[model samples]
Target: MNLDWNFFEEHFPLAVSSLKNARSAGRLTHAFLLCSSNAEYRTAFPPLLASLAACEHPNEDFSPCGRCAVCREMAEGTFPDLITLAPSSLSRIIPIGESEDEVDSMRWFESLFYLSGMTESGWKIGIIHEADRMNEAAQNAFLKTLEEPPPKCMFILTTSHPAELLPTIRSRCQTIQLTDNRCKYSFPNSETLLPILHKLAFESKGSLLTAEDCATALIEFAETLGEEAEKTVAEKWAPRLAESENLESAGKALIEKRIKGEESCEYRRLRDLFLSMIHAYFAQLALLVSNTPAELLPNPELFEHSIRQNEAEEFGADRAFRCLAYAEDLLRAMRTNANDQLAIRAFCLKIAFK
Candidate 1:
């Protein structure tokens, strides 16, 4: 997803046309709710929205000129007036800060909304990525901001799970659902988990060794989640760290702390993504076993080379439903204080023996 017009034109033409019309008529809403299960689209839309609203030299159809200062600033993620927030802490919920000074909290975002640095377009944009991650208090606080929004500000809240948000919050914003044909539950590690699921469904013989082997695979992957996150953070921060070679001790410490925080947040996000993939596997298993068509499944790709409707009878739909429940339970448990390896081991054993 390049933050360019072609991305929208090719992938989301209707959304592009609608927003173009809104901007053309000066009817662009102060707040927009962009809902999509396509993670790529969800991740790409907000920055594009900001570019559309604040681009200094938009074309005839309100498409952003990708060469202007606003576009450059946005591309570099240094736009002063564009604030983006996502789930940050280890708990993976956006919090309402105790005070407005907390950098990553909703209160801090609210305070930024009212500050007086207007860009060339006089628009201040705040995007809440994965807005459903906002807990009750954060959502209520955001609802207050929505009710009394600042002048010349646009709020964009994006979520893959809209049901997790408050009703009032949803009502206050104009919603734009991005529709696409991409698999909703595809993740970075889907390939790794798909084979494990295939084994659980079609290869397992209910033996302790088979169950332990599945558990070992899951545990191995879980152990390295943090390493994967750190690798990503290192790649992103390499240039900055090199440029800061002469910085003072406190500045260096601050940067190091931020990098550490980023690593932790990235690990948690990846872990949740894997958990989500596990749930999707079992869910599609249940649906496929119950005679659902592959084309109609949430993850149709999982069935391309793996399970057939007729062969799925080896692991009946009833047991698939139970495994789906365990996957849900695993997700909930991981969200709490439950240890990741333990949870994975327990879940694998249950699925293998069920």
Candidate 2:
């Protein structure tokens, strides 16, 4: 992807057009806050915007010429006049030095703001990704720099959740909201799957990319789980049901193990996959209600009863939407350090009953 132009063309054409106008008018602001909910877009858009500002051959169109030395450097992440920051690599939080020498080093890097513009173009650009993740001290440290922005310098702050940012800092910059565009996908005679897929994409909270990944993972996981469940019901359950105590003991052990493993391993990836699956499942239900033929649906057995009962509108569509909302809430809680097993189990229970 020519991150500078192609990506922006898809999600934020209006913002890109505005940027072009600003560049043409020579009225580009010294600071910009690119606010968005999609982390992938949030991370990618700033560099593209930075390239636009720093491009050697910035035309009136606001697009950067990828062949130019400045654009190439920015794309390669080696541009001298551009700086970026996030939580430190070694530590999950921005590093704060305790010793005098350490503080001096930090201050020296911070003082780069005070220096005269070093590049021949006389423009310096700084990008801070996850600006909301900065700790109190780091925020305070950057506050002075943001308030007294240097000449010929521009700061671009990218954040997924702009509300988390400090009000004082946010007030200093021009804010631009980047909303996700609905991604278009084509399916061959598989129109039955389209509604389900669309629902999943929407549940992904504007990240169609995440929704696609989730859908693939869900299909794989569901296949594996279904096969396992069938095998257990046929071979294991039939033999063990006669011995009820043995079945109970085995089930308890298995549940305990899964819960323990979930607690130790970060389940963000799995939670995302599961949520995507739920979205797809509900979307399919909605389509079924809308008269999508049964044979075209994935897991037709799952929707057979609802379809035959003619309760698709009253039951299927509404239930699917409710499940989608639940999945989003679970995802949010999981990101905030909530108990993974409990969250996953709660979501599963809801879906199973619904």
Provide the TM-score for each candidate, comma-separated.
0.82, 0.57
lDDT of each: 0.78, 0.58
The weakest ten consecutive residues by lDDT in model 2 span: 261-270
What lDDT tens digits, residue by residue, belong to model 1 across residues 1-354?
Answer: 353678777777787898989988988888999998655566567777878888898988888888889887766555667777777765767899899989778988789887887565677888887799898999998998899988888898988788888999999998988876454544456577788877765666587787788888888877778898899888888887887789998878866766775576566567666776777888888888888878888668767888765688777878989989988888777765447778877887788776
Model 1, C-alpha of 11: deviation from truth (Å)? 3.3
RMSD of 1: 3.4
**Model 2 Cα displacement at 203 (Å)?**
19
TM-score, candidate 2, is 0.57
Pairing residues by index, what is the TM-score of model 1? 0.82
Q: Compared with the true structure, what per-residue lDDT tens digits does model 2 show for residues 1-354?
A: 333477776657787788878877878888899887544455557667777777888654767777788887666454666665554332334443453234212243356566776578777777776677666776777788887877878888887668887898899888988875331221112234444444443345445455555455444443344343344334523433444455568665643433332222112222233444444556566677666887877656444443453545555566656766766666565455335555554554454444
Q: Where does the lowest 10-residue lDDT sum fall in candidate 1? A: 181-190
Candidate 1 ranges beyond 4 A from true positions: 1-4, 118-122, 184-190, 240-269, 292-300, 308-310, 335-338
